[model samples]
Target: MSTLAPPRPSPRTTASAGLRGPARLVVRQHRRAFQLLILLTALTAAGLVAVALWAGHDADVFARTGCRVDTVTTDACTRSTRAYDDSQYRLNHSLSVVALLTAVLSAAYGAFMAGPALARELESGTHRLAWTQSVSPARWLTAKLAVPAALTVACTLVLTTVCTWFSTRGTLHPLYWHDTSVYGTTGVYPFAQALCGLALGTLAGLLLRRAFAAMALAAAAQGIAVHVLQNVRGHLWPVVHGPYALARSNPFPRDAWMTEVGYLTGTGERLPMGTCFPIRGKFGDCLDSLGVTRRYADYHPKSHYWPLQLVESGILLAVAALAVYAAHRLLRRLHA
Candidate 1:
């Protein structure tokens, strides 16, 4: 008896079969997370565009009113400055909120990575089934991390680029280059921070293997990282010390980060500016009485902005690398 040859698989079926691996499984399992990531990216892009357009409109108004001239006392100048400052305040506030939201979402992503993506599978014994199939445990973990890591980095880079563009606009209202929120969002720092979060989450997942515990630990780790980094950010670059008069022209170059201003004693010691507090008579007289020979400041010049950002980014990336390495080692040990 001649058995009918089995029908050949269709091209679509063949293609789907070829895709039946760890990578596709990871995508299918976390499809909702990926969908949310796309939505978040679109919203962030739209918000940034809206802010840019609004700032551009305000800038146009400032230009039409001829408020570019340096005038501190004219009624027109005062009105113009007020309008400009108001617009700036709104822009900065909005940007700050967006930056904060980005940070929060990044941290939440870390927690999700730990809880839902990794630990849940381990907890439910689903990972064992995946391992027994065509996927090895290491490959399964790699696929899980590779997808989210790629998406996170791509989205963060886009957001950072948009933020950098917003920062370059010459609106009457200017954001300080050293402002924490501004700096965090406008450079490579955001990308590093997001990657760090992802690595920390993965490590947490491997360690705890319990969804809630991993999520909580990952979130806490992210919070501690942000707090510590913020506290030490000023020291990431060398501080330039100089006569404070250099600051008097504009308090600082528009882009310089003025960290501290103080009195320089005749003996060459630095005293808090508070020593000259409550300037009563001549400011110099008050300083002389305090044995101050000159005014001084500790600052990071505008030129140091990139250096500072690079330093911070490097530190964060190093931490992320360590976390990832530790996760890999832990996985190997567990499976050994």
Candidate 2:
């Protein structure tokens, strides 16, 4: 008698088989949400690419005309500059809106995770049914957190990368780097903020166990956290201090973030900037008469961009970790 060999699994079957019970359940339950997210992400990506191309073309036109703001005074230079400025403004404004939308989406994600993902199950006693059927509460919670966390991270990375590319290459706009709207979407900040939202939402779900309440709390918490972080971001890194005299003609380095510019007394006391003002007079004479030894500026140079981004990201990530830990502890207590 010929023994039948076991049937070989197809690629689809093999892939499906790899997903465990909790993972499978989580994916199935959130499939619609995932689909929506993917669609939105794809649309955003396409728009960004289009903006990049348009901005790039405008930049090329400006470059080809050899337009220098300080020297070029020809009609071609004037037209090129005007066209480039308009393009830059449009693209930069669009990107800034996208950056703001990222934060809003983060809040929405948090609310959804808190309400539909975890809190609904708890509130409806569905979690208990799952727990009875081979799935532990911890495993269920893990799946809930892990799936969204993974998706959030991937989406954040892609958007951040696109924004960075647009800001650096597509537009010749200076100081776009330090703008609040641009800063949020570039570098590691987006990822950190996204993770913070996910973690906080999970914690809210575990603590409240009421879908609507959890969602509300999570969103409120996210708003507060974002506000605080935005205000404190400039202080996270040491600013480069330069004499105001040298900086008078060209304050701060090219594209640097000027945090403060003020008068400095010979005794090293910092005075308000008004002491040297009334621009009609000779600046040196005005300063000498006012006993202002020099003017100084505290600024973050372009080189410090990465450092500031990383520092802020680190703080956000730490907050996320704490939220995650608190969520786990809350889950354990409820189960006990």
Candidate 3:
């Protein structure tokens, strides 16, 4: 009798050969979702790069005319200048929107975690079967969160790095770095937002055990968290202030985030923007009557971008950690 050699794993199994135990099992269940996620992400990132390259070519064509790209003065400028500016605007706007969509999807990972990942199992009692097969509640929960979280971070990293690179190197337009949609997608901050969504979704699923309800709750919560963070981000770091003399002038760079613009009182107190608006009589007389000394402006300079990103990311991560802990405790109470 011929001796049989060891069997070879199938190609599908071989591709995922390294994954074992709960990790592999989780992947098997959500393979379709993962496939769809990766496909969409790849297409979006490709579009971003393509747009950037097209913009670069347009910029070069416009510059060759020896026309000042910034000012539209009639210097025998060809129609190419207007066309170039229009193209740049469209491309940059597309870049911002697509990158923002990717970030939003990362945050929507919570809905997956809340519905199909956790609540589905709990609602249908599938988790009980896993628990009987040498898997505790904690192990089961970890498997659900860890695999998806890893995928979220991986997808986010690729898209964000591409966006950041395009924003810095590819964009020749006058787009500001701190545009809300653009900022939300560009750094470690989006990664933090993803984690926060995942944890909150987990918590919601654990509490509700109903897929639809849990998903809705998690998504709404994530949206609120994102909005709250974005709203408060400027205040996270002290802004660079412009002197009263520069009030009527923008001393900050064109790309800086202007947090405030107003007038300064003689006693050095800041006044609102319309302090002398509608200019009754002489502008100087109105200023003198109101004790307005000069103009005041507050802005976060370009250099402060990274610091703002880092600080907000830290705060979000802390919130995510607490949410995870609370989820674990609740699961333990329910099971034990």
Candidate 4:
């Protein structure tokens, strides 16, 4: 007896039966999460900009600086005073607002971005839909991954630009001392490094396989490490090589650095504090004090900004990438 030949799938039938391509699937999968993130980001950005404009020239970024001027060095005091007096407080205040929004955005994205997609896929077995389709598991993951990474990079670049502009004003001294964001010159703390934080958060989500858990891990890890490292690198480590040295002979340590004011102690007569006077070092080491006869002197520390940021961000991002790779491998192996 003759057997009937098996029917082959027609292009139309195949197309109708098959799953959509990876790109479309990725979008479909993450549409809700993306919408929420976009809404949150837009609202945050608008609020910050509005507040900055409304509060224009009235913010107190410089008020604290003015208070410290009398006892600090000339340039530091003068710059701080002029910054306050010039009514340029808007720029510095704007930065603080921007920094806050950036941090919140990073944390929000980190907490939910990867977890929403990955955890549900694993738990619901919907991942099998794509896994059995034309799309490789790798491509499926890549498309989903690319969206948040792109969003994070764009946001971070914008924040960094704003931070640099705000930092140039010299009025946000206390904010910098406290916040310590790696995004700008003054702020320390690893969490201040928005790009690194976002990337690490994504990786954390992948590793923990739970949205809230991953977010908490990312926030705590980045927040604590960045804060601690910022201080150590800025104050203790020679991460940024300033133009001037902190040698004892330099007579303008306080003027050079308000932070160094307490460290000032003259070898000779405790030259009346707050007066610029000549100090005799050695035969040819004569230097005039800019109201400082002892303690460490400094030049502009702005130059050190890029290098330290590079190192700190680099390290955090590297760790994040590794974590993500490990998680991906583990998931693949478990599936196998």
- Give one digit per residue, the lDDT tens place, for model 1 in 8-121: 999899655644577787788888988888888788778878877876787678778876546666788778777777777777777787789778976887898899999998
Question: TM per model?
Answer: 0.85, 0.85, 0.88, 0.60
Local accuracy of candidate 3 as per-residue lDDT tens digits, 211-313: 9999999999888887888788889999988875733556567888888988888799887887677886787787888888778778988899899999999
Instruction: Judge candidate 3 at residue 157 and give its lDDT.
Output: 88
Clashing pairs in 4: 73-255, 180-187, 180-188, 181-187, 181-188, 189-226, 189-227, 190-226
Name the regions of candidate 2 deviating beyond 4 angstroms: 1-19, 59-83, 170-172, 246-248, 276-290
State how far residue 331 of model 1 sits from its true place (Å): 1.4
Q: Please give the CA lDDT of all the candidate structures.
A: 0.81, 0.83, 0.83, 0.54
Off by over 4 Å in 3: 1-19, 67-78, 169-172, 246-248
lDDT of 4 at 295: 43
Between which residue pairs do clashes occur in model 3? 247-295
Instruction: For model 1, state the Cα shift of residue 230 in Å.
Output: 1.4
Which pairs clash in the backbone of model 1? none
- Clashing pairs in model 2? 244-295
lDDT of 4 by residue, 186-296 (tens): 333233355455556655756676656766887776666556655655454252222233353444323222333222334533323333334434412333433333443
Q: Report backbone clashes per prediction.
A: 0, 1, 1, 8
Task: Please provide, for model 2 over 203-321, each residue's C-alpha lDDT reduced to its tens digit, 9 standing for 90 to 100.
Answer: 99889999999999999999999899888878999988888663357555567888887888788888877765666658777777667766788988878879989998898889989
Worst 10 residues of 2 by lDDT: 167-176
lDDT of 4: 0.54
